[model samples]
Target: MAPLMRNRSPNNVPNELNVEYYRQRASAGLIISEATAITEQGQGYSNVPGIYTDEAVEGWQNVTRAVHEAGGKIFCQLQHVGRISHKSLQPFGDPPVAPSAIQAKAKSFVVYSDGTSDFIETSLPRHLKPFEISGIIEDYRRAAARTLEAGFDGVEIHAANGYLIDQFLRSSSNQRTDLYGGPLENRARFMFDIVGCISREIGPGRTAIRLSPVAPSNDVHDERPQALYNYIASQLSAYDLAYVHIVEGATGGDRTYQQGPEPFDYAEMRETYYRTDGSGAWMVNNGYDRPLAIEALEKERADLICFGRPFIANPDLVRRLRINAPLNALDQRTLFGGDAKGYTDYPVLGG
Candidate 1:
């Protein structure tokens, strides 16, 4: 299952509602939890769960325990939204941090005191100092450690979606001249550092990462995506990660969208990883249906397929796919910041 932010954790702590939610979908072989904040500084959307605080960890403990008890393996997706966040979401209303001070052409979800929320323009961000970078990396390390404490089967670093890690990797977002921003290698330093740290904290076999090479989600782009991501795939060979999850094309949009002059070749990226001895499972996501997913596996293009929204409306998505049953229609009005009405209330085949 793909990570989909339901924004139901009012205090950044998963509640009983959350535990029941995951337990219902425990049929999924592996469920990737929603993008979870690694620190207060990493939060972007309102009500999204966090992994830093003791309460947050305790909240996730319930989630993982329920999933495990129901026979499901789950991974927590650690995330830092960087400049994609608004000051309202940041600690003490401070400006969000980014690779550069540039603001993203994006919006963030903010809930007002009146119990209402709306998407607001992301605030201008402050450039991250060299010293601050290490602190954030440490935050990721701590988050990874917390995942084990919370009883997660593994963890996936949210390096995609124009978040903090993705902000550092994209040339358009990163303008630093230091060891973290010029060439492809420099731009990828932050990612590798986080991956290495997490792998050390939790074995690489339990560590994975999600990347969106060509997806222009959160308004991020690199001059040479093909070259940049190909290099990343090769470098990833060093860590025998659990898997490499790639978001193909525009996230939640066009599946054939290209971010550069040349069309991004996902097959080439996988080949590069394999040639360089990266032996991780290759997972692909983005507008996939049963036919497309089967075609990918049959053609040996992907080892696993991720369904995001489909899982939102179908708690028994695994069985639905297996039997080729018609899926429940997603309620557009209740996609985020909602109760069980559109969440765990979705009926299954016989329930």
Candidate 2:
């Protein structure tokens, strides 16, 4: 299962609702939890779960235990929103930190005390200093350690979706003239640093990463995406990662979105990783249905296929796909912050 954010974890801690939610979907081959904040400062959306504090770790323990009891393997997706955040969600209302001071032309989810929540313009951000960059990398390392302590089988780094690591990877978001910017290698430094740290913390065999090479989600852009991602793929070959998940096309939109002069090459990137000795499962996501998924696997286009929205309303999605059963429609209203009305209440094939 792909990581889909449902802002139901009030106070950024998982609860019984989350435990039941994952337990229902335990039939999946592997379940990647929603993008979880590594620290309070890494958060951008309200009511999302975190992995840093003792309380948050304990909350996740219940979740992992339930999933495991049901025979499911789950991974925690560690994330930091960086500039894709509002001051209201930052520590002490400070400006969000990023590779550069520029603000993203995006909105963040925020909930109010009156139980109201809405999307708000992301606040301006200050560029991260050298020391602060190291600190953030350290945060990822600690989060990976906590993930295991919380009973998770593995950790998936949320380096895509215009978050902290994505901000550094794209040229449009990073304009610094320091060691961490300018050249493609320099822009990619931050991502590699985090990958190295997390791999060391929780062994590369349990370390995975998600990337949207050309997706323009969260207003991030690049002059040459093909070159950038191919380079990233080649570098990732050095690590013995568990898997490499790629979001094909634009995030939740076009499956053919292009970002530069040359069209983004998904196959080329995968081949690059393989050619460079990348020993990881290649997981492909975005806009997949039963037939499409079957075709990809039959053609050996992917090692694993991940379905996001279909799994949201179909906890028995694996069984449904096996027998070609119909899927349940998603309740758009309860997709974000809400109670059980649209969550675990979704009916199964014979419920």
Candidate 3:
């Protein structure tokens, strides 16, 4: 929901609308919240929820309580937008931070100070100073702590969708010559370290991460896509995260986006995860439909499936999919920032 711009406090905290929104959709077996900011620098857009404040924690407590009452499991997605931000959205107008100093080719989803949404051209980001990296890792750990305090089943580290983690993981975006760049092993160090830290804070069994092997969004690319992802799966095998959520193709792109890089090992990454001796559940996402999801599970391609857009208008999505019921066409106009008109007003099947 990208925060829904629904805070009455100075901090962008979730309110009752956020609670009721999740409550209404509690039929979902596992609800992964929208990518939430872990720090002010990470709050890349207007009104997204923050986990660093007391008010934010209490607000989330209400949401978790509601979802639990409805018998649904939820995981908070911790995301740091890094360079995909505008000066207006940054902390004290600081230049957005990335692994290196580079301007992304894509535009940012910006909400101006005057409360207007616009696609602004991304600005050049400053290379992260070595001193700042440790603090960012702490940010993830603290945010994961808050996720547990909010009574979530676990936390999903947002290492996908060309965000900060993806920026560091890909060779094109990360030109840092220090320990963070050059070799594939070094490029993935940031993710491994952050994951290790977060997992340490909130038991590895309750810590999870999402990654995209070859997503090109936000001007991200890698010379060895398969190598990077395989390394990721292998390294993560050492830690028993709740799951390794993978976007089967370019994140949120076509379902048949691609079969992987040359040599196209369709299930190589999957095999790599299993090689960990059943380290964690394997999840597949990106443009998945109901039938495809079932087929993938039946074929043992995935342990769980993540459906994105379908849950927008269908609060009773589970029942609808189970019985082949019709779905509501979510009005896109009210998607980004809105009140009850679109957020909490989506009717259930018989409600």
Candidate 4:
């Protein structure tokens, strides 16, 4: 559900609201938790949760316990918004880090330096040090371990929406002469290394990745997305991940203007992954309603379909879709920071 930015605590601890929220929607077979930061440095927006602290771990454990008790499976999405941040969001007023010092030609949700929380233009970031890069990888490793400890079924590494990993994969964001940048293979090396490390640290079957090949989100773009993702999927085939979730077109935006003018073929990408020995579930997201989801499933376009907006107001979304029931419109005003008015008051069927 988009509009999940409920910055309730400085430490970003999950509370009763979180547990109740997930529990109410437990009917959704696989409930992927919202994107969470791995470390304080990974935080981008205010009030989002993290898995790096004792309070965070304890809080998410409560959420997991609730979901599991309700007979639901959930995965925690680990995300690090690279240059998609501002000084007010970073620790000690440090600039956000990226593969290159280039500022994203995009805006981010941030607490302005003047002390107001709002969506503003992203600030320029400094290049990460070689050692800092390794440190970030270690953070990811620890984050995965923490998620497992908190009793999550698995984790989906966030590599979409112009986040940390996406910046590295797209040449428009990464203009470095080092091994971590330049050619597509080099640009993609960081993701493989992180995925390989996490999979090894936390078992491949329990790890997954979310990617947006041609979305160009967060001011990131590639000259050849088809070749880029073909290589990525083909290379990913070596790992035994649970699945690969792709954001078709863009992440949480206009569905009509999808994949840009030249969209990469999902069929070709799937073929490449399978052809290269990739063995995992394939998931597609973005602009899916019940009818489209059913069609995609029937046509075998995807193994799983993720619905974002629908879940915001429909706790019994799975049942609603199954029976073709009407959905409730989301209250846009209560989307970001709010109490339980629109957050948890949305009625289920017959509620």
- Write down the TM-score of every candidate: 0.98, 0.98, 0.94, 0.94
Q: Model 2 over residues 122-230: C-alpha lDDT tens digits?
A: 9999999999999999999999999999999999999898999999999999998999999999999999999999999999999999999988899999999988999
Per residue, candidate 4 scores C-alpha lDDT tens digits across 1-351 of: 322355544447888888888888888888888889998878877778899999899999999999999999889999899998877788998999999999988876654345556778888899998888889999999999999999999989998878999999998899989889989999998899899999998999999999988776788988888889999988988888898988887667755444446756888998878634435689999889888999999999998898887898899999899899999998877676556787788999988
Backbone Cα, N, C clashes tallied per candidate: 0, 0, 0, 1
| Best-to-worst lDDT order | 2, 1, 4, 3
The C-alpha lDDT values of all candidates are: 0.93, 0.94, 0.80, 0.84
How do the residues 134-205 of candidate 1 rate in per-residue lDDT, one tens digit apiece? 999999999999999999999999999899999999999999999999998999999999999999999999
Best by lDDT: 2
TM-score of 1: 0.98
Report residue 309 deviation for candidate 2 (angstroms): 0.5
Off by over 4 Å in 3: 1-10, 258-266, 275-279
Q: Candidate 3 residues 1-351, lDDT tens each?
A: 111223222356878888898898888888888778899888666778888888888888898899999998888889898888888878789899999998998776665567767768877899998879988998899999999898888888898877899999988899999998889999899898899998899999888888878767788988888787887887888888888888766665665555334643548887776543654788878777778888999999888888776787778889988998888887877766757786788888888
